[model samples]
Each structure stands twice: as C-alpha cells, then as structure tokens.
Target: MEYFALTNAWLIPLMPAIAFVLIGLFFKRWSALSACIAVFASAVSFILAIFAAIAVIGSGISVDAPFVGHVIWAEAADLHFEMGMLIDPLSVMMLFVVSLVSLLVQIYSIGYMRGDKSFGRFFAYISLFSASMLGLNISANFLQMYIFWELVGLCSYLLIGFYYQRIAAREAAKKAFITTRIGDFGLLIGILLLQTVFGTVDFLELRQLLPSYIASYGTGTLTIIGILLFIGPIGKSGQFPLHVWLPDAMEGPAPVSALIHAATMVVAGVYLVARAYFLFASVPALLEFIAWLGAFTAFFGASIAISQREIKRILAYSTISQLGYMMLALGVGSLTASLFHLFTHAFFKALLFLCAGAVMHAMNDEADIFKMGGLRKKIPIVFITMTIGVLAISGVPPFAGFFSKDEILSAALSVNTPIYIIAVITAFMTAFYMARLLFVVFFGEKTNMRLHHISCFMQIPLVLLAVLSLVSGLGGYIYDFGYWIRFGAPQPEHMDISIAVLSAVLPLLAFILAWNIYVRKKWSADCIAARMGVLYTISFHKYYIDEFYAVLCRFFIDGIGRVMYFIDIYIIGGIINVISGLVLFSSTLLGKIQTGQTQRYAAAFLCGVIILLLCGILYFNKISGITAGGGVL
Candidate 1:
C-alpha cells in the first residue's frame, strides 16, 4: 500500500517500454529469450496496473498531482509537460482493461506464434503496444495523451504489418496508419485550440475551467471543436467514411487483431470522446450529430458484416459495429454507459478474437468460414469459448454484452426514438451475422482443408475470457457515472423491460432469418443474387463506401502527392541545380588560386582586410561627417 501510494502510474507503462527496447534491440541475438523477457515484462506491468487501479479507486479523486515529475520539453510558451500519471476512476478502468487484455494476448501469442521466425520481434512490438496504450490511458494531460496516442498508432501499424513479406499485410497497415493519421491531425488541432482557450491540457484542470464558459460559445465554436475532436474517434473507432482500414486489418495475425482491433487501439476513439464528454455536452448539436453518426455507422457496419465470407473480417466489421454503440452512448451524453459498454466489450470481443485465433491456429491459418465446418468436435474448447463470446456479443440474457448493449440501447431510446430504432436494428443484424458465422463454422459439414490441434496455453486464455464475457455483467458496475458517483444529477428515464425484451428478441428473429437463408434452406450466392439484385450487390460492396474512398483518395491524396512530386522534381530541383552550378563554377575558379601555399592565403587575407578597411573609412566619411571631426567619429 505504501509503495502504491508513492509509485507513479507511469512506472506501469515504463516497464513495458523498457522491455520493448531490450527485446527489440537484440531480438535476433536473443531469439527465444527475447520473447520470454517481453512476456515477463508485460506480466509484471499487468500486475502493477491492477495495483495502480486499486490505489486509484481507494484514494478516489486526489487532485494534488501526487506524482508530479517533469523535464523541460518546451520553453517558449511556458509549456512544461510533467512525466506523471493521473489516477481517476476513468483512467483506472482503462488501465485495468488494457493491461488485462494485453497480458492475455501476449501469453496467447506464445502458442499461436510458437515457431514464427519473428516471434521475438512480435513479442517486442506487443510490449511496446501495451506500454503505449497504458500510457495513453493514464496520461495526465492532452499533450501526453496525444503523444501516446500516436505511439499506439505506430505500434498498430507495425503489428498490423508484422508480416511485412506479405503485400496485403503491408498495404493494410499503411492504410490503417494513414487513415487514422488524418483524424489524429484534427485531434491535434482541437487539443491545441483547447489549450489556447483554457491555458492547460490537464484533464481535471480543464474540467473545472470549462463549466463557466459552457454558455459562452453560443454552440458555434463549441460545435466545430467538438466535431473536430469527434473526428479522431471516428477514425480510431472505425466509423463511417473512415472505417475502411479496419476490415482489411484482418490481414494481420489473429493475435494482433485480438489485442489491437478488438480490445485496445480501436477503442481509443471512444475513450477520447468519453474523456472529453464535457466539451461535447456543451455543444448539443455536435452531440446530436455524433449520435446520428454512430447510428449510421452501426447499421452500415452490421449490414456489411452480414455478407463477409472471411471469419476475421466478420469479427472486424463486428468490432466496427459494436464500437458504434459505444459512440452512440457517448453522443447521447451517456459517457458512463459508453465506458461500461467499452469495458464489457473488451472481454467479449477479445474472447471472440482469441477464439478465432485458436481456430486459425488449428486450421493452419485458414480464416475463410466457408471453408471451415464442424470444427466443434476437433476443437471443443475453441467451440465452447467462441459460443460464449457469440452469445455475449449477441446480447443474450445474463451475458456481459447483454447488460452493456441493453444499457446503451435503453439510453439511446431515451434520447431519441430514431436512434433507438437504428440501434435495435443493428443489434438484430449483429446476432444474425454472428450466429450465421457460428453455425457455418462450427455446426455444419466438415469442409476444412487441413486440421491441427490447439495448445493448452491458447485454450486456457480463451476459456478465461469466455467466462468473463459471460459473468462480468453480474459485477453490477454502474453504467451512469453521474448517477453512480454524485458528480451530476441523472437526466431522463431509461427504457423498461418491454423495450429490452423487444430489442433482445429482434436478434433471435434475425438469427432465424439468416438460418433460413444460409443454413436450413441452403441458398446459393446466385440464388440470393437473383432474388435481391441491386440490394444484394450494394450489401456485398459495403454500399460502395470503399469505392468512394478510392475515388477521393485518387483525386485528392494521390493527386496532391503527384503534384508535389512534380514540383520537387521540376521547380525545386531546377533551383537546386542552378545553385549547384554556380557553386561548382566558383569552386573551379577558387581551386586554381588555392595551391596549398600559405603565402597565397596570407596575401588574400591581407587584401580582404585592406578592402574592408577602405570601405569602412569611406562609409564613416560619407555618413558620419567625420572627415576630420573627432567628436562625430
């Protein structure tokens, strides 16, 4: 307890960073030991994270900046970012979730990536990712958070492209990085503007400073900033118009997908919005827009997920859809609900992804659900774990996802009927698609290309996560911070059991519908295509969102890059060449005069001195009127 009292939360993240450096720097030399070190370091950090969370929760909102430590990062504007940690409830929850999932994934990777050539490097990157995410979670100020935000993005890029030998993996990683960077730029500007307006980036300080001006911005400036800040979440959380990178991110290893996409990186956007909920709450219109955006993304992502053939891509789009629910919770001023969903989601989604990894490991990395069938008998542990994950994600009764998803849906209904409708429809689609995936993969005839056995290590984590997915809801954690903590009064009433039952039943209906089409009736692609025509085409193509992005990228980013390349080649290079020619000519002329003779150098020096003296004398005489006037001189 004393150590917890004095220890900086920064130490939790620092340990992983140290591990990353040591493992990565000598990965090739250390090989097997490097991974062990990475895993050990992560395990330690995970333990520290739990201690930090306990300390934070026990102490409960100390505002004295207890662990303040600093170095001069910048001086001109008096910006001094201290290397410290803030241990509020929000930060504590994020620390626990991130550390727990990251530790499990790292351990699971030991089995999944057992014989890979880059195993050491893989663990190193995983450690770096854990450190960055934990740092981002506990950051005391926006600048520090932003730095770690970009660091997590960097780790995501590296991990997503870990199989650099594969072109698809590399391309997917680049797309993920570049797309998210666009939103990050918006986030950076919003943070700078906040600092300009509030004079500080510290969260507690800004929270206190913002209430007075809640009415001053007249909704215009606040809306712009709020929306700009929301852009970061849109990109990071895989919302509409910026969600293209996430599905393709399935090209990475399954373990990477489990940690980054399902449990951590993708959730950063939701965390950002929830973290700055006060700013958004001040701009009602912006919050409303966020609600609509989340609703749209949920419907859009779920619809696309319905048709995905790849097992991981289905989960990837499922993540996008589920993240939309969290965004909806945030947009509707249900920050605690969003965080609650985020917490429960970490367990279930991670369980789903890890189970997927187990299946992939058994099938020699085959991810096509169409090619996989009746795997339950072969991989019973995976089947059971995945069933729990699917049930949880489907919002079945008593499961973790049931409570969180129902809470968000209830909140959305209370906010607006339209959003509730959209959310409910998305839930139905989620169940349908997820069940469709499960039935086809585990309950059908055997169609697998090859099969192998999964290790006990991989199965254990999957089983543990599955249990969490089922029972985390029973912990009775409050989903409304204001109501639970007495920070602010609760607003409107939530929907009752009738609404919850209706919403829950919609998914079962969808499951039956999908079952009729894809399983029981055995509808072929051509038959569905013939029946649905353009509707089928649109769903299959993800409503042409990716194509729209392709056009936009071709006309804007690629076009601008080409223009800049031309300018660099023609105009800038021409000027450089001209300067180079003049320099070369002068060098040629001076080369002849420098014959390695000290006498020649002395003569040139004396000549230059005489010329300077003459010029000085003439200027003094001309300007100072000091021909013979000593007083003026």
Candidate 2:
C-alpha cells in the first residue's frame, strides 16, 4: 500500500481525468452513466488519496524533503522542462481533502441536478475540475503547479458558465476569469524571475538553495518576488480588491460552488501561499503585510454577509470570510493552523453548501432566506445538517472550526496585537452573520411553495459531511494534525487556554445576540440597521466594490477594448480599403483598354508610338531655333 501510494500518486489525478474524457466523449448521451462514471472515478481517487495520507504517516514525510518524481518534457538550448509529482505531508493533506469533498459534491449533484438537460455535461466539467485540483495538489515544481492552477481556473470558467443560457452565469464566468488573470500575470512574471535568478523552478531545489540565494541577492529582490507571487493567491483566494468575483461565482450550480468554495479552486490560493512559505518567511515586512491584509479581508467578507438576503450568496460571503481566516493563519507564520482550518473547512463548508442545495431544492429554487421559515420540520435532515455546519463554521466548541480558528487567533495574538484585535472582531462578525442566516431561514413564519423531493443520494453526502464537521476538529488532538504539517521545526505545542476560551465564548455570544434579534424579537434588527445606515448599506452592497470595478472597466478595460476595436475597423481597415479602391479604379480603366483582341492591343501600342514621334519632332525644332541665334550652339 505504501509503495503504491508513493509511486502511483499520479494515478490519483488520472482517475478523474479519464472519467472526464469518458463522460465528455462517450457517456454524455447517457446522463445516468455519466453521473456514475464521475462519482465512481472520484470515489476511487478519494480512496487513493486516503492511502497517500497513510503513506505520508507511515513513511514519515517531512517538510524539508518531499518525495519527488520527474521526467523531462521539453528541452530548449540548455534548459529542460519537466513534469512530475511531489508528495509530502502538505500534498497528501490537500489530496485527501480535494478528493473527499469532490466525491461528496459529485454524489450530491446526482440528485440536485436530476432531469436537467445538461446534467451529463455538468458532471464532465466538475470531473475535469477535480482532476485539475488533484494534479495541482501533487505538482512537483512551480511550472507544474502553475499549469494545473490555470487549468483549475479554466475549469471554473466552464462550470461557472454551465448555465450559459443565463446572462448572470455568463457574466460571472467572464468576471472570475478576467479578474484572476490579473493576478496570474503577476504570478507568471514572478515564476519567470525565479527561473531567471535560480536557473530552475523546482520546489525541492528552491528549498535547498533559498537561504544562499537570500544571502547573495539581499532581501529586496526576494521581497518583490514574494509580493508578485502572493498577488496570485490574493486574487485566487478571494482576498480584498480582487475578491468581487468570488461571491458572484455562486451563479454556478450548487455542487460546483461546494467543490470550489470548499476544497478545490479558492483554496488553491491559500495552498500556494502555504506551499511557498520559505520565500515569505525570508521577508518579515511582507509577512506582516500578509497578516494584516488577511485580517482586513476576514472583516470585509463578514461585514458584507450580515445584510445578504440569498442563502447561497450569504454562504458565498462566508466562504470569502473563511478564506480570509486561512490567509490570516498563513500570514501569522503557522502553516499548520492555515492548513488545519483548510482541512476542517472542507467538510463543514461542503456540508453547508449541500444543505443550501437541499433547502433550495425544497423551496422550488427560491434562495432568499426571507422567503423561507419554519423549515426545520419540513426537511429535518437538511436542518440538522445545516445546524451542525453553522456550529462548526461559527467556531463553537468541539466542531471543526473551533480548534483551527483558535490556533489562527493564538498565532495572531502572539505576533501582532492589532491584527489579532481585528481577527477577534471578524470572528464575532462571522458568528453573528452565520447565526443570523441560520435563525432567519429556519425560524420565523413558515413559507409555502411547490416542494421538490430530496433524494437519498443528496441526503447521504450531507449526513456524512455533518459527521465530519462534527469530528474533524478532534483530529488536532487525536492525530495531532498540527505536528505533521508544520513548516519547520515544530513549535512548542500548547494551546493558549485564554485565547481558546475567548474565541469560543465570542461566537456563542454572537449566536445569542443573533437569536435575540432574529429569533426572540427582543431586539429590532431593522432599527439597528437604520441606526447604522451607511455602514449597513455599504456592507449590504458588498462595499460597492463590484460597482467600483464596473466604473473602472467602463473607463479603463472597456475603454481600451473600444480603442482597439476602432483601430481594427477604421484606421488599419481604412488603409486597406483605400488601396483596394485604387486597385479597383485601375483595373476598370485597364479593362477598358485591354480588350481580349489583338486589334485593340496593336492600336494602343501604335498610339503610344505616334505620340512619342510627335514629341521628338517638336524638341528638334526648338533646338534649331536656339542654335540660329548663336553659331557656337
């Protein structure tokens, strides 16, 4: 098992990849077969991923040295490009999470997407998505990682626009694609710079040589590279400024959302930062910036979620906020904490999104929480599962979120108080908004609509995810997950009891406050919003960030596109048109002269000769007249 796990890590990604091709090429005509292929392929991949994790544990894979396998793919002059796999604690963790979540989501999709005309195609796209992310997990070098990264991005565009008939889906796909490319461009440059300086982009090589490179080149150049690299994550992970596309990505199917928000696409960004911690660690100032920026994003996302109406959109904002916390963990120099949260987040978040799907399924696709109430009895399984997800995400005790979230706060508190303060505030806001969502949607007056059935296929993944969400936090104690995925030498492992208690208490208090306002009606939610008018309004509108980008696009992106279009249609085109017109005129005159007869050609040649003879006679007369005036002439 260990040997197979180590040697056949490539097969982990290959399973879903083969499924993708099969479904797209052959199985697409049969929706049931396509769904089965996708789910079975994902299940196999998940099984292999579990074995990979076991191999990591049994073999004692460490951070400093990871298993590397490679083969040269291209040669240019003195350079060689290789494709390979790198398996270690980090990759294995990501592999397990990516596969598990993808498998569950695919299974849940079987029910949620039933009877849709494009059902087979949806499975195909997500299969490709899973393949891309799994490939990204085991990438051996920067080149390989970036290739899979862009592939993941492409799959996102395809899946997000799966409902191509809808304007929202189409626009959202384009927005996500274009926005992330802005960061990807920077990342490309950074990778190129690394290759130029170090002569290779291999992870193991870089790890071995970074210390010497830092000493030789100074921190400034490394800092620039670090920032450029982080730009990719910032855009990918739904961090501020470039974060607008994340919430809008909810325009995709619910299963796609679960896959992306939970384990695959958005996590790619956080994973990248964690993967390349050595570079960031070398630059303290930049590291501090990351911590602060992450804290801000956490706050930003939570603030927006508070006033969101759509259940999926609320969860979307929650994804953003949670991603921010992962970034915060990365920034605070705890790779373990960051990845710990990442692991736990995959289970609970996927559960939450799937529950949202079940609820929407019941409500005939109405997503507004205001339109739903007293649904706990109607869909007991969904309500129960959703409640577990909420508790886990809200950082309540003994759930997945609490343990990981505590580590993030403790890490922050030990380093920077200001960021920690911001983190603590964000935690309360996260708890409040998530609790607000739960209470509002499941309580209040019951809403009536045409009910859609929730199938067994859908219920199973939700229940399993709820179980994981309940117990995944305990991995911190049972398995000591932190000790294995640590960046370097393990830090003294001790929980800050005070920090843990505070993080736990704050969330409970926030939950209580939400219950008061939304459940008991003891506090006026509307009155509070009215008092905080602009603040509430701003957050409700996602801080007008999307609108801000729209203005910039109109004045900048669209403006440039317009100019380019003008040049293509008029300036360059006019020159060609003028030349064509001149040729046409010449051809018309030539057509008149060059008749298809020897007589016409002979006549034209004779006329040209007679005109030349007349010019010669006139010139001779003019010369004779001048010579008559002077004998020397």
Score each candidate by Cα lDDT: 0.81, 0.90
Error of 1 at 262 (Å): 2.3
Where does candidate 2 stray beyond 4 Å? 565-633
TM-score to native of every candidate shown:
0.86, 0.93
Q: Point out the worst 10-residue segment of candidate 1 by lDDT.
A: 478-487
In model 1, which residue pairs have backbone atoms overlapping below 3 Å? none
Model 1 agreement with the true structure over 1-633: per-residue lDDT tens digits? 935543666777888899899987866456678767877887787787778756755655432233333444666666655545666667767777888888888878878888888888888888999999888887767888899999999999999999999999999999999999989999999888877877887777777777676655555666777777888888888998899999988878888999977667999988877767767877788888889988898898898898888898899889999888988887787876787788888999999998888887788888888888888888898999998999899988778887778778878887899999999889988998999889889877786466776887688889889988988765534333333321145432344798669857876787777777667766664687678888878887888987888898899989999999999999999999999999999999988997998998999999999999999999987876754566743
Q: Can you write out model 2's per-residue Cα lDDT over 383-480, one digit (the tens) per residue?
A: 99999999999989889899889889989888889888998999999899889888988886787766788999999999999999999987664678
Predictions: Cα RMSD each: 6.2, 2.9
C-alpha-based local distance difference test score of model 1: 0.81
